[model samples]
Target: MTLIDDRAPASVARTIAGISNGELSGSTCAPELTEGPWAFDLGMPGYGPGASQGDLLPAGSAAQGELPERYRRASGEELSSWIASAKASLGSRVAVMGHFYQRDEVVQYADFVGDSFQLARAARELPDAEAIVFCGVHFMAETADILTGPSQAVILPNLAAGCSMADMADIDSVEECWAELEARFGTSPDESGRVPVTPVTYMNSSAALKAFCGEHGGIVCTSSNASTVLEWAFERGQRVLFFPDQHLGRNTAKAMGVPLSTMPLWNPAKAGGGLSGEALDASRVILWNGFCSVHKRFTVSQISAARAAHPGVRVIVHPECPMEVVDAADSAGSTDYIVKAIAAAPAGSVFAIGTEINLVQRLAADYPQHEIFCLDSVVCPCSTMYRIHPAYLAWVLEELVAGRVVNQISVPSRVAAGARVALERMLAARPDTTMAA
Candidate 1:
C-alpha cells in the first residue's frame, strides 16, 4: 500500500475510495483525524476564533502520525474527555452527524444520526452552522454540502470512507445514456413542452449526476421517496428511466402495483434503448444495470437456512437486493421504514434481516428478547460509510473555531434552483403522513 499523500486533497480522496473498496489495503495506526484533550475542551467558547478549520493538528494537538494517548484508552470516560476537549477547542459551531450504521464509538458523539436523507435534511436545517462534521462517508458529506449553505462547511471525518453503490453511477455513463435515450424517446419536451425529459436519480449518486438531473428537469431520491419521484417523472415523460440500482426501481414499482410485465431491465452494455416494446411499451419504470454489492451478498439460501434453524422467523430486506431475494422475503422497505417495522414486530420474534452489517448488528443489539441477525452471517459494512472516524469530526470542527474551513460543499445557485424544482415535485407527491424519504 502507498503512504497517503497528506498534501493533496484529490489524492487523499482517491485513497479513500480505493481503501473502502478493498482495492488498497494496509494497516496504519495513527489516528489522523482525532481532535484534542478534554481539559482543554472547555478552553474556548462559542464562535470565538482560535484554530483554523484545516488545522487538523492544532498547536496543542498530539504528535503527528500517532494516536493521542486519550484515544488509545479503553474507558468511555477517556473517550468522552477527548471528544469534549476537541469540541471545546473547535468552538460551538461544530455538529457531528452520524448515520444509523456508524460504529458505536463514532455514534457516541453524533449530535444527529439518521438515514442519508435525514442527515441531508438536518444539514439543510442548520444553514447557519459553521461546520458539519459528518461521521459517514464521502458521498454523504457531499450530499450534505449540496443541501447546506455556501458559508457552512461540510466534512467527512475519515478521508478513506466512500460509497460503492454511489460510485456505480458516474456522470459520464449517465450523460452517455441520456444521449442515447433522446434518440429513442424523441427530444421534444414533455406534454406541456417545458422540458425534454424529467431525469430522476437516486440520492446515492454523485453531485454531478444530481446536476445532470437538475439541468434536464431531473430530481434525486432516497429509498423512501422513490415511488413519489417516479410518479413525478410520469407526469413529465412518456416513461421513467431510473438508474444505478435496478432492484430499487423494480421493488418500488412493484409495490406501487407496477406489474412485472410492465417493468423491464436496462443493460448498460447492451446496444440501443437496451430494450423494446411489449417490454418497453408495457413498462412503467426502466431500471439501470447497477446494484449494491453488500445487499447482493444476502441470498435466498441464507433466508431458508435461518428459517429452518429458527422457526417463525421474519425476513425483511432492502430494495437494493435482487427481485428473487425480495420475492422470497416477508417484506421490504427503506432504512427508516425497516427500523419502524422491526420496532413494531412482536417481542421474542426472530428476524433474519438483509441490509448493511452495521445496521443489522445495531438493530440486533438494540432489540433483545427478539432474536435478530443479518441474513448473511458475515462481518461487513458499507466500506464508504465507515470512512469517517471521530478524529476527522474533531479536525473539521476545530477548523471552524479557528475561523478557517475545509471541504465546503454547496450547490451553485443555478444547479440548486433546478434541483429544488425536481425535489419539490417528489415531495409534493408524497403525502404529509409519510416521511420515509
Candidate 2:
C-alpha cells in the first residue's frame, strides 16, 4: 500500500474505474463501483454504489432524481472551481460538515470534519450559519437538522446517501417490536424505579427512531458514547432494547460485563423475535438484527494477517464490527478513537484499522510518519457515504448560491421534538473528554 501524498490526485471513483478498466494496479470488492454514482441513481434503488450495494433499501424510501447534466458532465477541476465559487459567494452563511468516513475529495470542502457525534455538536454550535451542508449520509443530515436551529437548513448533497443499517430498523418494524416488548414485559417500573424496558437507538437511525426513543423515555447513543448511554439506560430500566446495530449494542453491553447468554438477538422478521418466554425473562439487552455492511466485512483472519505481516503491529477496530472481530483485535473503539490512537502512537508504529476505507486511506496520507492501512485491502468504502460525490456537492452549493434550497433534510416538528429530547440526553451522557480530527 502507498501512503497518500497530500490528497491522492486519483479520486476513489477514478481508482475503482482504473482497476475495472485494467489500467490501475489495485483490488476492489466490486467492479460495479467503477460506474458513476449518478448511474446508480438512474437505475436500481440500492445504496448508490460501494460496500453496501447488496443491502436492501426499505420500501417507500426516497430516491434521488437524475442530477442536472451541467453538473454531471463537468470535470473534477470544473466542479472544484464551481464549489469554490459557491462557497466564496455564500461566505459565513453556510457551514459544511463532513463525516470522517467521507472521501478526501468531498471532505476537503468541509469547514468542520469529524465523526457523527462530533458533527452533531458542530451542527448545534454553528448557530450563525444559515445552512449546514452535511457531506455524509441521510441519517447524519437528519441529525444535523434535528440539532440545528429551525432557521438553519440542513442539506444533504445527495438524497440517496442513506445508511443501510439505519434503514434496517424502520418505524413500523420498531413500533411492532416495542409493542411486543411492552406486552411481554409490562410497562410498569420496578421497585427501584427502573422500567421494564428502555429503548436506545444508535445515532445512525432516522429522526423518527430517535423521536421514538424520546417518547418512550429512552435515549440516543453514538459509537463514542454507547457505553455511557447504555449505562444511563440501565439506571432507568431493568433491561434495555437496543436497535439498528446489534454488534454495537452487544459489544458495549458485554464490555460492561453483561453476559452473552443474557443478550438475545431480536429478529424483526420473526414472531416475538423468535425467543422463548424464559429467554426474554432473563434478557439484559435485546439486540436488533442489523449491522453496518462495511464493518461486517472485517474478520479475525485479517487481524491475524496484519500481525503475521508486521510483527508488533497494532490492530484496532470499531465497535460496530462483529464481537469476535472486536475481541480478536488489540483494541476497539469509535472512528475518533481509532484516529486518536494512531495519532498518539510512537513514531514509525505500524497500525491496522478495521473500519471504512475512506478514513483509513486519509489517515495514511495525513500521517506519513507512521504506517497505517485498512485491515481489508480490497478497497470498499461505505456505499452510502460514497453516494455523495463531488459533483453532488458542487450542485448543492451552486444551488445554495443561487438562493435555492436543494435536498434540504428536515425532520417533522413532532419527530424533531422527540428526537431532540433523546439527543439532548445523549449530550448529557457524554464524558468530559476532548476529540480531534
Candidate 3:
C-alpha cells in the first residue's frame, strides 16, 4: 500500500499527481520511469494547498469529482477491451473525434483525428450520428457543438478537460477592452468607410468571445488562416483587436510587413491596455495579453541548440510559439502544416519540430526512416489535453450505451446563434496563397 516504491502502481500514480500539483519537482522525477503510454491515467493532480477551487477547474467546467472506482482501478488491458466493446456496441450512432494532441490510448479509439478546425468540420459531416464525442479540450467541444446540427448532441468525455489559454480571455475582460477602444477611436468609420476597430479572436477562445465577434463586425481565425482572417478584417476596419494569443498575431502580422511598432500588446489589467491614446491610434493590430502556456515554454535557445547539434536539420514550429522562436526556425505554420511538412520530406531527412511531444513521437514512429525529435528535452504535453484518459472515455461511452448523456456540452441558443455567424465567416474566408505561413 506504500506509495513510494519504484515498481508499485500506486507509487507511479503518486509521482504523476505530485508532478501535476507542483508538489514534487520535475527534476526529481526520473524521465525513464515516466515513459509508459498510460502514464497520463493518474489524472491531473488537484491544486496544492491554499489554491482556490477556481484554479483547479476551467471556466464553464461541470462539477466532476473523482472517477468511479471501476474506472480508476481498471487495468490498461481491461480498459482497452471495454472501450473496444463499447464502441462495437454503439456502432454508427456515435462518432468520436480526437485532436492531434490527445494521448495515443484515447486517440486509438477516435474515428477521425486532426486539428481543432478540421475536427470541427468533421463533426459537421456526421449528420446522421446522434452523439459526437469530442476527445479534445472545452473550447474545441464548444466549437463542435456550434458547428453540428441542433439535433446532434456533443459530449466531452472528461468534463474537467479545458484549455488554460482559452480561459485567459474571459468575456468581461474582452468587453471592457472593447469599451476602451470605442472611447479612444470615437466609434466612427474612417473616410474609406471602414469602422474604427474590428475584433479578431483566435480559434483557441471561449464561445462567448466568438459570440462577441459574431455580434460585432468581427470574425474568427485559426493558426493556418490567421493572416487571411486579418486581411479580411483590415478591409473593413481601421484596426484589429486580436485575442487569446498574442504570439500568433505578432508573428503573422510581422510576416505581412507590419512593423513591431504597429503591433502593441494589450494588457487587460491596465487602463487603455497601458497604452496612450496616440499609441493605440497608431497601432494596426492590438494583441491581447494571453498565450498558450505550452507553446510559451519553447524558446530561441532551444531552436539554436537543435540547429547546433544537428547540422542541416529542417526546423519547423507552430505559429503559437513566440516571435523569437518562430523567427529562428526554418519555417513556422499550423499543426496541420507541421504534419504535412514531415510527411513530404525525404526518408533520410532530419527534423527538429517544436510542438506537443505526443505528436512529435507519433511522427517519429510513423516515419521511421527519418530522424525526428522534439526541440525540448523535457517530456511536457499539453496538460489540459492530457486530462482526457481512456478510462474517462470508457466511462462516457458506456454511459451513452446506457442511454445517459452524462457530460453533454451544450451552448445556449442565444450564444450559439451569434457564435455561428463568426464561425461561418471563418469557413468562407480564403487565405492568400502567398501567406500560408
Please report the candidate that would top lDDT against the real structure: 2
Highest-TM-score candidate: 2
The TM-score values for the models, in the order shown, are 0.77, 0.96, 0.88
Off by over 4 Å in 2: 1-7, 432-437
Better of 2 and 3 by TM-score: 2
Scored against the true structure, residue 333 in model 3 reaches a CA lDDT of 87
Provide the lowest-lDDT 10-residue window in model 1: 46-55
| TM-score, prediction 1 | 0.77
* lDDT, candidate 1, 74-111, per-residue tens: 24444455567867776557778898877555676788
Q: Write the per-residue lDDT of candidate 2 for residues 93-113, one digit (tens) a residue.
A: 999999999888888899999
TM-score for model 2?
0.96
Query: Looking at candidate 1, what is the lDDT of residue 87?
Result: 77
Candidate number that wins on TM-score, 1 or 3: 3
